[model samples]
Target chain A: DVKVTQSSRYLVKRTGEKVFLECVQDMDHENMFWYRQDPGLGLRLIYFSYDVKMKEKGDIPEGYSVSREKKERFSLILESASTNQTSMYLCASGVGQGIVLTKNIQYFGAGTRLSVL
Target chain B: AQRVTQPEKLLSVFKGAPVELKCNYSYSGSPELFWYVQYSRQRLQLLLRHISRESIKGFTADLNKGETSFHLKKPFAQEEDSAMYYCALKDRGGKLIFGQGTELSVKP
Candidate 1:
């Protein structure tokens, strides 16, 4: 089975504080993604990494950045956290090229609910 | 641009009653569709994919290109089946666009 682990389950940060959310996958997948879940909006992609040092912005990448220094780890960074950034963040990993049907199935980690006060 | 839409924000059904969750999409190229479920206190996971054309946990979804829809259905709703269901669309590049999820509640 594939395992995706997020470093934190819940976090609280004051405004303008730098926040980091870490994720690690054991499956050696080439793709990792960060998403924020909000009521009625579903899950919106924040950033994704296809390979080490490769990153792409999704629909809502503002106020956030990502790092993929290694294959197994992906980190989401908030330059200066704001109250609007408070939400449940999810990390997912998938194998092979994302275009393929079977390979595109993503395994998600238990989300980190971040509270930016 | 590719998009997925799940119109219903919340759905309630009695146990043993049939249930259906509607999903629609808009994409120009060949699109891959998937249904994902998030159980209470659990991480989100893939429930089923349209390409497999298989039923999982007694639930099935058929992709209709003509109608641009992939609606999930089950003969009977169980308490255990209650969860948040998301409809997702995979673009050619492998980026998935997910719709606003539907919260299903199976009442006893």
Candidate 2:
């Protein structure tokens, strides 16, 4: 089975604080992704990394940055946390990405629910 | 731009009844469609994919290229099937765009 693990299940952070959400995958996937899940918004991609030290912006990358210093790890950073940033954050990884938008399959972590006050 | 759309935010049904969760997408190139399910306190997992063309847990989805849709259907809903379902579109970049999601509620 593919195992994607997150650092936290629930977190509380004050506004303007720097926040880090960590994720690790045991599947040796080449692609890692970060997403925020809102009630009606579903899962919106924030950032993704195809290889170590490589990153790309997703549909919603504002107020967020990502790091992939190691093969098994991908981290999502909030430079300055805000109330609007409070949500359930998800982490995912996959092997070689699809040739087009429809070919890839991303396996996900358990999720980290962060609350920014 | 490539996009995935789930018209329903919530779907409720009694156990043993038929159920369908709709998903539609817009993409120029060949797309791979998938259904991911997240049960309470569980990580999101792949339920089914169009390319695989298999039914899981009694649920099946047919990808209609002409209609640009892949709607998941089950002959009978189960209580354990109640969860959040997301439809995703993987773009040429190999990244995924997810739909708004549909929450399935099955009551006895």
Best of the candidates, DockQ: 1
The TM-scores, chain A only, for the candidates as listed are: 0.95, 0.94
B1-108, model 1: which lDDT tens digit per residue?
A: 688999999999999999999999999978889999999999999999999999999999998999999999999999999999999998867788899999999999
Q: State every prediction's TM-score relative to the real structure.
A: 0.97, 0.96
Model 1 over residues A1-117: C-alpha lDDT tens digits? 999999999999999999999999999998899999998999999999888999999889999999999999999999999999999999999886633324568899999999999
Compared with the true structure, the alpha-carbon lDDT of candidate 1 equals 0.94
Top TM-score prediction, candidate number? 1
Interface Cα RMSD in Å, per prediction: 1.9, 2.3
| Residue B34 displacement (Å), model 2 | 0.6
Residue A57 of model 1 has an lDDT of: 93
Give, for candidate 2 chain A, the lowest lDDT window spanning 10 residues: A96-105
List DockQ, one per candidate, in order.
Answer: 0.72, 0.69
Give the clashing residue pairs of candidate 2, or none: A100-B91, A100-B92, A101-B90, A101-B91, A101-B92, A102-B32, A102-B90
On a 0 to 1 DockQ scale, where is model 2? 0.69
